[model samples]
Target: MKKNYYYIAILAFVFVFSSCKKMLEEEAENFVSPSQFYKNEAQCVAALNGCHNPLTSIFNQGLILANEGVTDLAFLNNQNNETRFELSPANPGMGKGLWTSAYQGIMYCNAAIQGIKGAPIAENRKPALIAEAVVLRALYYYVLTSTFGDVPFYTDDVANLATLEKVNALGRMSASDTRKFLIAELKAYVDALPKLRTSEVPNNRISSSMANVLIAKLAMWEKDYGTALAALNEVKTIYGALAQYPLEDTYFRNKNKPESIFEVQYTWSVSGLKKTTQVACYFTPPRTANTSTYNGINIPELGDKANPFTSVSPSAYFMSLYHVWDPRRNIILAYTYNGQNFTRPQSGNGTGKPWMGAKFWCPGMDNLADGNNQKVFRYADVLLLMAECANELDDVALAMSSINEVKRRASQASSASINLELTSYPGKVEFFREVREERARELMGEYGRKWDLVRWGIWYESIMNTVANEFVDIKQNVRPYHEYYPIPDNEILRSDGKLHNNAYK
Candidate 1:
C-alpha cells in the first residue's frame, strides 16, 4: 500500500524548506516549463485549478476535518479507539493529516503565485489573477497560523522544489503576526478577484466577497469585534442575504451556488496528470451510483480492489449532536441501505448500504470524475459570523437577526424556523454558545467547526466538557498547546535542539 501523501507533504516540509531555494533556482527559468504547461489563458486557469488540487485526494478523502471535529466535536468523533486522535492525542496519520493538508495547500498556493506572476497575461487580467493568488496565499497563511501558531511565511512565491525547500527551512512566524499579514493581503487584493465562476472554477478560487468573509473571520479571531462586525456588515451589504434555498430540498441546493464564497473542487478523470478526483468515488458503495466496475463508473481504474478503509461511519457522539426530532440528524449521520434517511443511487437494489459522509455530493463516477465542489466559504457563513460578531458587540437584535438568517434557511421546511429577525439575542456568553451550536448544526461535517471552536478559545475546554459530560470520554485529549498543533517533529529538529515544546506537550 502507498503511504499517505498528506503526511508526506508535511514530512517533506523540512526537506522542502532546506532545499527549496536551490531547488527552484536550479530548474529551468521559464515561467512554467515547456515540457508541461504555460501555453495560454486556459492553461493559466487550469494551473489555478491545480492550486486547489490537494483538498480532493488527501488521506483518500477520509478528512474528518480539524479544529473541533477530531479534537472533540463531530466528524469522526471517537475516543479510546486505537485510531482515535481524541484518545491517542497525536502522531497518527489522522490528526497529522489535518496539519499536513493545510501546509500542502500553502505550497500549492505558493506555486500558483509564482506561475501566474511569470505568466504572460494582459495587464488588466493580471491583477485579477494576482488577486486570486494573493487571496489564496493569505488563506494558506491563515491556516498556517490557525493550525500551528508559529509557521514559516513565504511571500516569495516560487514553484521550484528548491525554492519551496528554502521557505520550508525558515520554519514559522508568530500566529499574531501572521494574522495581521493575512488581514493586509485580503484588504489589498480580494476585491479585484473575478466574481463570475462556474462549478469547475467557483470553489477553486477566492472572490471579493470571500475576502470580506475572511476579514470577518480574522477579525473575530483577533477579538476585534468592531472590525469583525464592520467586515461582516460589508459582506451582508454587498452580497445581500443568502438567496434562500430550502435546506431540506436537496443536499446540493445552496452548494455550488453563486452564494458560495469559496469551495474546493474535485474531478474524476483517467489521465490525471494534472489532478485526481479518485478518493470520493473509491469510497462510494460499489453497487450504486455507477460506482461499480461493471457500471462503468466514469473513473480511471481504482487499485484493482478498492481502498475500503476510507468508508465513513459516524461516531456515536456525532450522532448525538442533533436532537432525535432534528430532520438533519438522519440525513447526515444515521444511515440505511435503503431508506429515506440513507443516501441514494445505492446499487444492488436497496440492499446496498449508504454509509455516513454523503455530504461531498460526489458519488459514483469513473476513477477520475470530478467530485462536486466542497463549499469552504459561503454567504451563509457570513450571516453566522455576523451573528457571532453582533453577539460579541452586544447588539442582541442584530445578533439574533444574523443567526436567524442562517436558521431561517436551515429550518425553512422544518417544524422550527429560527426567527431571530424580530427577537433579541441572549447575553454574550449565552449567544456565544448559541453561535457554536448553530455552527455545529449548520456547518456540521464541514471543515469549519473544530477550528471555529478553537478560534473562540473554547475548543479545549468545550471538548473536555463535551467528552466528560456527553460522551463519557474522561480521557479526551485536553492541553493548552491543543490550541496550536505541534510543529511537526522533523521541522523542529532543524532548529538544532533550540525548539521549545508546544504548550500542550
Candidate 2:
C-alpha cells in the first residue's frame, strides 16, 4: 500500500482555491488551466484529492474546539474569550475556519465533478470517480448547513468569469432545500461508489457503505427515522455479517479499523501543514515533569515532551458522568499524568478543569503536526443511531439490543461493573436517556456532542442550565440565537447582502 503522500499536492491546491475567487478564473503562469488539467485518470484523481483536503482543516483543533467547547463535554481554555453562548458573528472563535474550509472543499468537489465529466477516462471508471466527488460535496454541505442553518448552496462549477459573477450574486438557500438537495444527490451517487476501497490506500477513499452511513446521518438530522433506518440497515446488510466489523475499544488510535466506515486520512509524511491533524496539541495536557504534587500525591509527568498547547479541557460536568469503573472515563479524561494517577484538583488552573484523555495524545510527536486520522463515521455510531431510530420507531427490543452492543463492548474492555442490561432501565424514556448519555461517553472529543444536542432541540436549554449553574458569568448570554452559529461576517460581505445572518437573533 502506498502512503497517502498525494495529499501533499492536494494541500497546495486547497490553498489555491482558498485565495482565488473562482478556481477556473485565476490560472497561475506556471499552472495548467482547469480546462486543460483533467485529461486522464491520474489527473482526475488528483482533482478529487484536492476536494478532500479541506476536511483536514475543517476537523482541526480550531473547529473541534468550537464545537466541543460549546457542548457540556468540554470548554475552551479561558484565554479564547468565546464562551458557549457568548459567540457572535464577529467572534474570532465562532468557527470561521470551518465555514470557509467546508465551502472551499465543496467548490473543489464541484470543479472536480465538472472536470471528470470532460476527461478521457474509461467509461467504467467515470461514475465511481464522479460519485466520490458528489458524496464528498454532500458531506461538506452537510457540515455547513448544520452549523449555520441557511447557507449559499450551489452545484455548478464556476467555469468562467460570468458564471463566477452569477454564483457570487446568489442568495442563501432555505435549509429545507439544502437538505432535500443533499438527500437526492446522495441517493443518486451512492450506487456508483465502490463497496469498499480497493486502492493501495484502503480507507483513504469513500465507498458505498460510507455513503450509506452519511445518508443515515443526514436522515436522522431531518428526524426522518424511516429513511435513516433503511440506510443503516443497508450498511448492516453489507458489513454486519463480517466478523471484522464488531465493536472494539482500540478503534480510536488504530487507523482504518473495522469499526471505521469513513475517516479523514492524515499522515506525518504528507509534507504540508494540512498533512497532519493538530488534535494532540489542543487536547493533550502540558508536558511538565512529575515534580508537582497535588494533595501530597505526585502528579505524574503529564504529556510527552511536545508542544501540546493544552488549550482545551474536559468539563467537571462531563467527568462527573462517568463511574470510576467505566472504561471510557480513563480513555476520555486524563486524570493520570504519565503512569501515576491522581484526583482532580478542586479549583486552580484557569477555572481548574481536568485534562483531556490519552485518546488524542500522540506520544512520539512533540509538535503541532500529529498524524491522527479523524473518524467521520464509524460502526459504533451506526449502532447508536440504529438504537435511536429503533426507539423512535417504537421497537424497544431492537433499541435495547443495539444499545447493549455498545455497552457490551465497553464492559469487555473494562469490568463487569460497567456492564449494562436491558433490565437496568425502568422504561423507554430511561432507556433513551441512557442512549444519549452513552453517546456522550463514547463519542466525546470527536465533535458530535453539540450537533447531537442541537438535533434533539435541547442545545439551548441544556447549555443555559449548565451555564446558569456551573458558569454564571456566561449565563446571561444563553439565548435561542446560539443554537446555530452566525454566518461568518466575511461570507456575508462577499455575498454583497445576498447572504443574511441566521434568523434566531
| CA lDDT scores, all candidates in order | 0.54, 0.69
The residue-by-residue lDDT of candidate 1 on 318-344, one tens digit each, is 555565445555455435322333334
Model 2 has an lDDT value of 0.69
Q: Which stretches of candidate 1 lie over 4 Å from their true place?
A: 1-47, 57-72, 75-83, 86-108, 111-121, 158-171, 195-204, 248-255, 269-326, 335-362, 365-372, 415-422, 468-480, 495-500
Q: How many backbone collisions does model 1 have?
A: 40
Candidate 2 lDDT over residue span 1-505, tens digit each: 0123234334445555343321211222223456667877867776776677678778766667656765766665454556645677777364688887887788789888998998998988998899989899988988887788778888877665556667678888877688877887888888887765322124357878778887887888888899889888877766663224433434345677766677776666434433577777777655444333432344343223456664565666687778777767767776664556544434555345566776776645535767777776777777889999999998888788888877777766675455544555457787777888888887776667878888888887777656446655557556777778887777778778887775634
**TM values, all candidates:** 0.72, 0.85
What are the per-model numbers of colliding residue pairs? 40, 0
Q: Which stretches of candidate 2 lie over 4 Å from their true place?
A: 1-31, 92-94, 197-203, 241-252, 269-274, 289-304, 337-339, 343-354, 416-418, 424-426, 502-505
